[model samples]
Target: MNDFVTVAVFDYPHEITVLKHLLDQAEIDYFFENETMMNIAPMYSQALGGIRLKVHPEDAETVREILKKLNDESNLKIV
Candidate 1:
């Protein structure tokens, strides 16, 4: 929702869920727009047409930094 900012971006359902789970584990509140199985068909998304994970605009930088740090620690890159 607009209440949260767009902190980072993910490729598809997996990334969306992963980021959401991370935020949940950290107790950071977030909002998401999932049109995959809703309006826009995932089959047509071409791997990039899926859910969208959003965070509070104010928390955007914070969430991104945290995600980056997590990715760095695990040698993983968050989309």
Candidate 2:
């Protein structure tokens, strides 16, 4: 069984896209919950707690570090 953990939550599609790209580049496996739901009805994103990025528990720390580095380099924040 894969133990996944939420690393971040984003309300915007573009933000999720960017983070997915970073995770891909670093070869970190991840999945986003509520992405389809958010796409279907953006207004519900807030109520649904936004889109959640999940990763293996073992990769959670690495994912966070990568996100932080990307944010720092781009002067953008992903939460």
Candidate 3:
């Protein structure tokens, strides 16, 4: 995980619902930092720098492309 880098940061847990499914479908290696805490207390999202979408460095570009597609296809964009 030390080599993993943040690909994105979502402000709320709900925003990541579809994203999670998408990542799974794409078979991408990734994890959401602060996801559990955000689920417990959404207000702390900003304080914790939101829920970080961390991925292996090799997978970063792929994850970013997926994120871009998701954002392009949905009205609710992920930060």
Q: Rate the local accuracy (lDDT) of all candidates.
A: 0.63, 0.83, 0.89
The runs of at least 3 residues in candidate 2 whose Cα sits more than 4 Å from the true structure, single-residue gaps closed, are 73-79
lDDT by residue for model 1 (9-42), tens: 5545556656667788878777656545534565
Cα lDDT tens digits, model 2, 1-79, are: 1588888888867777777777888888889999999989999988999999999999989998886787785675545
TM-score, model 3 to reference: 0.88
Better of 1 and 2 by lDDT: 2
Per-candidate TM equals: 0.61, 0.84, 0.88
User: Model 1: which residue pairs collide?
Assistant: 4-55, 4-56, 5-55, 5-56, 5-57
Clashing pairs counted in every model:
5, 0, 0
| Predicted model with the maximum lDDT | 3
**Model 3: number of clashes?**
0
TM-score of model 1 vs. true structure: 0.61
Arrange candidates by TM-score, descending: 3, 2, 1
C-alpha RMSD values across all candidates: 3.8, 2.7, 2.5
Candidate 2's error at 59, in angstroms?
Answer: 0.5
